[model samples]
Target chain A: MTERGLLIVLSGPSGVGKGTVRKAIFESEGTDFEYSISMTTRNMREGEVEGVDYFFRTREEFEELIAAGQMLEYAEYAGNYYGTPLTYVNDTLDQGKDVFLEIEVQGAMKVKEKVADGVFIFLTPPDLTELKSRIVGRGTDELSVIEERMEIAKAEIDMMSHYDYAVVNDKVELAVDRIKEIINSEHLRVARVIHRYIKMIKEL
Target chain B: MTERGLLIVLSGPSGVGKGTVRKAIFESEGTDFEYSISMTTRNMREGEVEGVDYFFRTREEFEELIAAGQMLEYAEYAGNYYGTPLTYVNDTLDQGKDVFLEIEVQGAMKVKEKVADGVFIFLTPPDLTELKSRIVGRGTDELSVIEERMEIAKAEIDMMSHYDYAVVNDKVELAVDRIKEIINSEHLRVARVIHRYIKMIKEL
Candidate 1:
C-alpha cells in the first residue's frame, strides 16, 4: 500500500541552521515532503517576490482570513504579520503529500493544537555556546539582546517535550538527512488504533 | 557525545515470524545490540547449550532469583520458567549496548511496568488468513488446536495499541530490516526521557 505523507512540524532555536537542513531534506534520497507556503503581511526584501520566500498578502486579506478562521495560526512580531493557511496544509496532506512548516516555537505549538496527530520536530543547536555565537554573529546586537535571545532559546528548548523528535543541527546537511530519515521511519509505524475488521479472503 | 541504546521489547502472535526477524536482527545489523539471553528452567534442546538459547537454571535457582528481585519479569508458560535477568541487562546497557528482548505480550507489559522507559515493538501477520495458513503449516495438531491458536492470534493482533511500535510481518526479511531501521532511528532520537539528562553543549 502506498504510504500517506507525514505531517512534519519542524522548529529550532533562532539560528540552528534549520533552513539549511530543510533544503538538504528536499535533496535527500526517498524524501517525499513538500513545503507549505505561508501567507504573511510582511513586505518582501530587495530581491524576494510573492510566492517565493512567502505568499505575500495585504493586511486586509490576512485579517479577512483570520476573521473567517482560515488561518491555522498567526502572530505579529516587530510590526510584521505572519500566519499559516489552513487550506494549503490540508490540501497537501489530503493528497498524500508530506508538508513542512518553518515556524517558531509558539507557532509550532499552535500547529500541533490544530492538528492532533502532527509530528513535532525540534531542531537543536550543536552546542549552546555555538548557538550564542550564531545569535551574536547576526551583526553585533547588544550583549543584552544576545542574552535575551539565549534566554528565549532556553525556554524554547524546554518545550522539547512537546516534540516527537529532536535533531541536533551541528551540521546543516546531516541534520536535514536525519529529518528526512525521521519522515521515512514514521511511515513504518502501525496505526495507533485499528479495529479487527477482517476481510476474509479465503472465506470469499 | 555517544548516544545510548534504546531498550526495545518485541512481541507478537506465534505465527507472525517474530523469531525469524529476531534471528535476522542478530545476523544482519545488530552488532550494537546485546541480544538478551533469557533464563529458563526448561531442559535445553539438542545443541542448545547454556547462555546461548537460554540460561538454563534449576527451578530452585530460578525461584531464588525471583525472590531476590533479580528477574526483570518472569512467566510460567507451558510448565517452563522463563525470565529476563535484570543485572545482565543493566550491566550491558551501562556499556552502551542496545538490548533486544524477545518476549511475550504479558511479559512485555510487565517489563514496561518495571522500566517505564522501555519501547515496545509488536509484529503482526499480513492478514488473518495468512496467519491461519502459517499456523496450519506447522502441522502441530487438529482443527481444534488451530482454531484455538487463531483465536489467540486475533486477540494479540488487536492488542497492538499497547505497543509503542508495530510492523507487519508480510515478509520476514523485510520485517527484520525494518526492525533494524527502527532501532537505528530510535538511536538517533535525542529527546527520549532518559536522554534528557544530557547537557546540551555550548560551543561555537
Candidate 2:
C-alpha cells in the first residue's frame, strides 16, 4: 500500500534563514519534495512561472476562493491578497509526494487549525545577538524597520511552544540536515504504520 | 549548556530482527550510543564478558539492587533474576550520551512509566507470514511453541499504538536508518529548545 505524503509547515521570524535552509534542502534532494505554490493578487515578476511560482489571481477571484473555503490560510497585506490554495496541496499529497509550506507564523497558526496532523517546525536563529546582526547585515531595511522586525521576532519566537520541532539556523546546511532527519523520523511514527499492520493481520 | 541525552526504548515481538537492526546501527555509528548493560543471576556462558554481556550477579545481589530501587525493570524466570540496572543508564545519560535499551514489550512499557520522557520504538516483521516463517526458520522451538509465539506477536503488534515510532524490519539497513533519524530529530523537539530560550531571554 502507498502511504500518504507528509504535510510539513515550516515557519520562522524574519531574518531566520528559513529560505536558505529550504533552498539547500531542495538543492540537495529536489525530487523528494514539492513546494506549495501560493495564490496571490500581487504582480508576477519577470522570471516567475505561472503555476510553479504562484497562481496569480484577481482580487475578486481570490475572494471567491475564500468564500468557497478553498483557501487554507489567507491574509491581506498592504492591500494585496496572499493565500494557500488547498486543492494543489491535496493533489500533490494524494500523489504520494511530500508538500513543503513555507509560511509566516500567523499563517502557520491558521493552517494548524485546519490541518492538525501536519508537522509544524519552527526555524530559529542561534541567539538574539546573531538574529540582530543578520537583520542589520541584510542592508534592506532602515534602523527603525530593523528594530520593529526584532520586536516581531521576539513575539514569534514565543510561539515556538506551538510547534512540534525547532531547528536553530546556526548553519544552513546543518539546519537542512536536521529538518531532513525530522521528516524521515516522522514517517516512521506508529500512527503511520498501524494501517499497514491492520491489513497484514487481516490477511494472516 | 549541555543538552540531556535521549533515552530510547526499543522493543518488539520475537523474530522481528530487533537485535540485528540495533547491531547494524551500532556498527554504523559506534561512538554515538551506549548500550544498557543488564544484570542477571543466570550463570555466565563461556566467552561471555562480565559487565559487557551482562553484569553477572547472584540472586541475593540482584534482589538487593531491586530492593534499593536500582533496577529499572526486573523479572524472574526458571529461578533466575534478569533486569536492567538504572544507575548505569542514568550515569551514561548524565554524561550526555544516548542510551539504547533493547527489551521486550512489557519491559519497555515499564520503563516508559518510570521515565515518562523516553522515546519508544516498536520494531516489527514485514508481515505476519514473514514473522511466522522466521520463527519456524529459527528451528529452536516446536510447532506448539511457534504457535504460542505467533499469538504473542499479535498481542505485541496491537501494543504499537502505545509506542512513539514503528519500523518494519524488512531490511536491516533501512530499519537502522529509520531509528537513527528518530534519534536525531527527537533532539530538535520544541520542548527541548524552550528551556534554552528562557535562559537567553532572561539574560537579554
Candidate 3:
C-alpha cells in the first residue's frame, strides 16, 4: 500500500501575505503538492474558472455540505460560506499526494481540531510594526479598521503556539524554501518512514 | 540568552558511507556546524595536524579524562582510546553553535543516552545487497570476516528505532541535501522556536 501524503496548512493573521506566499509556493518549479481548491458560496468573479478558482456552490448547497459534516473546515464571512471539502483532501492524501491548504487562521484552527497530524504552519511577519505597515500599505482600509486589524493580528500571533512551525515571511522565496524543507524532513521522520526500513530488515 | 544549538549525531551500520556523507556536509559551502574534533590516544600520522586531524593525547591523559567523566563517549580500539570530549560539545552549544558528531552506531547510542535531545540520524544503504557489495568491495577482509560484519550490520540496522531519522545513502549529494533539510526543519520546530514568538507577542 502507498503511504499517505502530508496535509500542509498555511495560515496566518490578516495582511501577513498568506495568499502571496502560497501563490509563490505553487508557482515554484519544485512544488509537488496538490493545491486544494476551496468551496465557497460567493459568486464567481470575472476571469475566474469554475474549479480552478474555487468550487463555487449555491448557499443552500454549501450549508447542506456543512450540515452533513462533509466540510473539513468552514467559516461564514460576510454572509458567505467558505470551506475545504473533506472528500477531496482525504482522497488526494490516500493516493500519496500531498495536499496544500491556504486559509484564514480561524479556518485553520478548525482544521486542526479534525486533522491533528496536519502540518500547520503559521506565516508570521518580521515584527508587529512590520505587520502593521503591511496592513496599512494596502491603502484601502481606514485608520480605525487598520487598528482593529492590528489588534486581531496580535491575537492571532498569540495563537501561533498551536502551530507546528512558525515561519517568518520576511521574503516570499525564503518562506517557501523553509516550508519545503519542513515537508521534506517531515517525510524522513522515523515515525513516518521507519516502517519501510523495518519491513526491509524482516525480508533480509 | 541565546538558544542552545542542536546536537546532531550522524551514524549508521558499517559500510554505509557515513564518513563520506559527513565529510561532504562539512566541506559544503553552507555548513555552519562545528565539527566536534575527537580526542584519541593513537599516534599522530604523517601530514596530520595536531588539533585539526585529531586531538592527539597520551594514553594516560585519555584515561584520566575518561575517569573524570569528561569523555562524552569512548571505546578502546586496537589498544588505543578514542572518544568525544564533553566539555567542547557543551561549550560550543552553550555559545549557540551547533555541534555535529559523526560516529559509529554504538558510539551514537552512548551519546543518545547522555544527550537526550540530540538529533540522531541513521544513515542506511539502499539495500542489504548493496551494503554487502560495498563491504566486500574493500578487498581486504576474508570471507568469514565479511560474513561477520554483515551480521553486525543487521543488528545495527535494527537499532534504527532509536534514531530520529533514517536517510538512505543512495547518492552522497542527495543524502547531504536531505541532512541539510533536516537541520533546517529542525530549527523551525515549534517546540524549539515558539519561545521567541511568545516574547515577541509579549513585547507587542
Candidate 4:
C-alpha cells in the first residue's frame, strides 16, 4: 500500500507574508503538492475557474456540507462560508498526493485539533524588531497602533509552541527552501517510514 | 550564547557504504560540519597529520582517558584502542560547530545511550533482495554463508527503530542529498530553535 501524503499547514501572524511564501513555494519547480482549494459560497469572480481559484459552491450546498461534518475547517465572513473540504483532503492524501494549506493562525489551530498528524509550520518574521518595522512601515506611525499590532504579533508567535517546525520568513526564497527541506526530511522520519521496512523484513 | 551544534551519528549495517556517504557529505560544498576525529593508540602512518588524521595517543593515555570517562565510546581491535574523545565532541559542539560521527551500528548505539539528543541516522540498502544480490555479487555464493550474511543484515536493519531517520543508499548522490535535507530540517525543528524566539520575545 502507498503511504498517505502529508497535510502541510503553513500559518503565521498577520502581515508575516504567509501568502507570499506560499505562492513562491507553489510556483517553484518540482513542487508536487496539491493546494487544498477552499469551498466558498461566494460568487466566482472574473477569470476564476471552477476549481482553480476556489471550489465555488452554492450557499445551500456549502452549508449542507458543513452540517454533514464534511468541512475540515470553516469560517463565515460577510454571510459567505469558506472551508477546506474534508473528503477531498483525505482522498488526495490516500492517493499519495500531499495537500498544502495556507491559513491564518486561528484557522490553523482549529485544523491542528482535527488533523493532529498534520505538519504545522509557523512562518515567523526574522524578529520582533523587523515585524514592528513592517507594521510601522505600513504608514501607521501611531504609538498605540504599533503597540497593539506588536501585542497581537506576540500572541500569535506564542502559539508557535504548538508547531512542529518554524521557518523564519526572513527572505521569501529562503523560507521556501526551509519549508521544502522540512517536507523532505519529514518524509524520511523513521516513524513515517518504518512500516515499510518492517513489512520488507516480514517478506524476507 | 551560540546554540550547541547537533551530534549527527550516521551508521548502518556493514557494507552499506556509511564511509562513502560520509565522505560525499564532507566533500560537498557548504557542508560546514566538523568530522569527529577519533583518538587511537595505533601508530600514525606516513603523511598522516596528528589531529587531522587521528588524535594519536599512547596506550596509557588512551586507557587513562577511558578510565576518566573522557572517551565517549571505545573498542580494542588488533591490540590497538580506538574511541571517540568526549572532550573534543563537547568542545566542538559548544563552539556551535556540528560534529558528524560515521561509525558502525554498535558504536552508534553506544553514542545514542551517551548522547540522547544526537541525530541517529541508519543507512540501508534499497531492499533485502538488493542486499542479497550484493552479497552474492561478492562471489560468496555458498548457501550457508549467504544465509549468515542476510541474518546479520536483518539484525542491523532492525536497529533502525532507534534512529531518527533511515536513508536508503540507493545512489551515492541521492543519499547525500537526503542526509543534507535531514540536517537542514533538524536545524529548523522547533525543539532545537524555539529558544531563540523565546529570547526574542523576552527582549521585545
- Each candidate: fraction of true contacts kept? 0.31, 0.78, 0.81, 0.70
TM-score winner, 1 or 2: 2
Of the two candidates 2 and 4, the one with more favorable TM-score, higher being better, is 2
Off by over 4 Å in 2: A41-50, A56-61, A76-81, B41-48, B56-61, B76-81
Q: DockQ of candidates 1 onward, in order?
A: 0.35, 0.75, 0.73, 0.72
> Which residue pairs in model 3 clash with each other?
none
Q: Give the CAPRI class of candidate 1.
A: acceptable
Candidate 2 lDDT tens digits, B14-118:
779876777688889623889897778999977778987678999899989999999898766436777898888988888888899887787788888888889
The per-prediction CA RMSD against the true structure, in angstroms, equals: 3.6, 2.6, 2.7, 3.9
Point to the candidate with the largest DockQ: 2
Angstrom error of the Cα, residue A192, model 4: value is 0.8
lDDT by residue for model 4 (B106-130), tens = 6778898989988989998987888
| Model 3 TM-score (2 dp) | 0.90
Q: Where is the poorest 10-residue window by lDDT in model 4 chain A?
A: A74-83
| lDDT ranking, best first | 3, 4, 2, 1
For the second chain, the TM-scores of the candidates in order are 0.84, 0.86, 0.88, 0.81
Looking at model 2, the pairs that clash are none
Write model 3 residue lDDT over A1-204, tens digit each, in one string.
Answer: 899999999999888988789889999888898999889888887787888868999999998998998999998754678899999999999999999999878789999999898899999998878987888897887889878777888888889889989888999999999999988888887878888888878876
- Write out the backbone clash pairs for model 1: A128-B201, A128-B202, A129-B202, A129-B203, A130-B203
Model 4, residue A96: C-alpha shift (Å): 0.9
Identify the runs in model 3 with alpha carbons over 4 angstroms from their true place.
A41-50, A77-80, A142-144, B40-50, B56-60, B75-82
lDDT of each residue in A99-127, candidate 1, tens digit only: 99877787788898888787788888766
